[model samples]
Target: MKEDINNDRILLERLKNGDISCFEILYSKYSGKLYNYVLNISKGDFYLAEEIVQNVFVRIWEIHRHIETEGSFGSFVYTVGKNMFLNVIKNRMQEYLYHDYIIEHASELDNTVEKEVEYKMLEEQINKLIEQLPPARRKVYILSRVKHLPNKEIAALLDISENTVESQLTKATRFMRENLSPYCEIIALGLFQFYVS
Candidate 1:
């Protein structure tokens, strides 16, 4: 076990320095064990198992520079795989819950008129929140978020630095998030559409 740890530490250093052979060696050493581990936990979902293993390796490569040389690399890899799996599960649950909520709410609304009214109310609430921001912060928030402009673009449009644009947007978002905690799910659903598009 001690020798194995030392060997892994050396390999990790080489991998961090961009050695493809070291990456291949590391993959070969761990991929089978990781795959079978994920496969068992995933309850025989072969495709998902394969994807998780691949993602683990990809993540390792991406964060090679940050990899610790004093600990078990296998543990780090397993932690990454576990986190990925949990994220997938969390996202799926959120989707299921969102659909369930929408279905329940849709039944209550029943008609297009009610739906329109509800939508208008939500939009007005969103606008009201935006209106509460300080004037400069509101402009930055609107340009960066509502108008879907990049920070650089927002800065150029407002004749400010990109850092200023980012700072103001961050403050605006923090304020909104703090005040709108109750509406987080609705806000996430609304913004997620924009993010995906």
Candidate 2:
């Protein structure tokens, strides 16, 4: 363990100097443990776990310049990974609630033969919500969630840092949560129960 800690310090030093090979070494060493830690919290959502792990490494790389090591670097990485997983859970819950709101309202209108009309209205509302977002945030959200672009791709396309992409997505998701919460609580609860079961 002490040897691993010493190696991490050396790897962190190399990473701080913009050594991609060192970053790769660190990633190869830590990715599996971090993935398992994230997976447990995400309920085995591999994609989400992967995203969180990537973000944690990216953050470590970004902050390497100023990072003052007070303890084990591995512990630091784990702490960041855990927090990222929590954020993922929160974001997932919000998204699930929003999607559930659309489906539930659609189901209600289906029985009355106004399903098409109701679905269109819900779609319009969702679109409007997206439109109301700040331009950068909306773009990031659309590119990532709508167009299925990875964060790195979105960052490159937008000429922004990956952290910026993550930030924009986080903001967009929080905005959606605040807007959709009142209208979607029942749906959220039902979905949560279903998932728990």
Candidate 3:
């Protein structure tokens, strides 16, 4: 264990110096263990586990210069991986809950002509933004959000992996959010009206 710690310190030092070989070495040492750790937490969801592991390593690589070599890199890896998984779970749950809320309370929304016009305008703006996405991403976004398809269904329908579907949805939604956030109220109204309609 002491030898392993020394090796990790040396590897981390090289990693900080932009050594891809040392980075690969560290990845090899921890990826399987991290995958298993994440796998158990995901309740055997292989795709989520794989996604979390890859994201954790990518994040580590992104901020390698500031990594603390004297500390336990294993613990760091697990901590980062766990946090990433939790964030993914949190985001998924929020989306699911938001969808459920729209379904359950959609009819309760005020049905005024002014509100209908506002929702239509916002919906048109959102549609225009979505049209700016790359073709594959646009298709995925439409299938997932507009058509109310699940990731697995979208993947099967498009002959792509769930990871691809998830990635496309992430990028698509991020693009939408960045472009439309200033009109957040209108967008919310659009989404609520969209579902209710």
Candidate 4:
């Protein structure tokens, strides 16, 4: 907790100075948590939660120059999300209309989970394919992809040269592409899109 606070302070200081990377890193760290927090409070109104999260970030960007670098950026964003949600609710007519619209479109909303399920199924399929890889290639590929290790780290761990690690990764990726893409078009559009495309 202390480390995260200190890190947020550093990121906030950089963001106030107009550093886009700092803003991006902060977004990556907080966006999912913020979205989930808002989504729960908004009673599973996906669109409303999404809007509040977007507004929170936009407000942060707008006020970057006035940001207090010593404070908790996480708390600041959540407070903003909460306040924005409250303001939306205070406009009772809008909330009523939004809920009415949601009730009418509940069936379509139900399909959203199916897409997520499909993505997970695709992930499982990919993992099975990975298991079929040659041993050395499999280790290098897992270290690179699943563990997200750099080529140098992978090489050091495997007691091989960086060039060898790179070669193994290349071959492993080609194998997945050739085997999976032929049967799974899901790869062409999902997170694994780069592999198939």
Best by TM-score: 1
Q: Model 2 has how many clashing residue pairs?
A: 0
Clashing pairs in 3: none
How many backbone collisions does model 4 have?
Answer: 0
Per-residue lDDT over 1-197 for candidate 3, one digit per residue giving the tens place of the 0 to 100 score: 34644488888998989988888888989999999999998999999989888987887787687677777889989977886776578568767876786687778655657667877777788889988999999999887677555575466557788999989888888888787767677656436334212
* Residue 71 lDDT in candidate 3: 78
Candidate 1 wrongly placed segments (more than 4 Å): 1-6, 108-176, 179-185, 188-197
Clashes of 3: 0
Segments in model 3 whose C-alpha atoms lie over 4 Å from true places: 1-6, 108-197
lDDT of 1: 0.72
| Over 4 Å off, model 2 | 1-6, 100-197
Ranking by lDDT: 3, 4, 1, 2
Positional deviation of 170 in candidate 3, in angstroms? 27
Minimal lDDT window, size 10, model 1: 188-197
Error of 1 at 72 (Å): 0.3
Candidate 4: segments with Cα more than 4 A from true spot: 1-6, 93-197
**Per-residue lDDT for 63-91 in model 2, tens only?**
56655444677787787787667656666
lDDT score for candidate 2 against the true structure: 0.70
TM-score of each: 0.59, 0.47, 0.56, 0.45
- RMSD in Å for candidate 2, one decimal? 9.0
Error of 1 at 57 (Å): 1.0
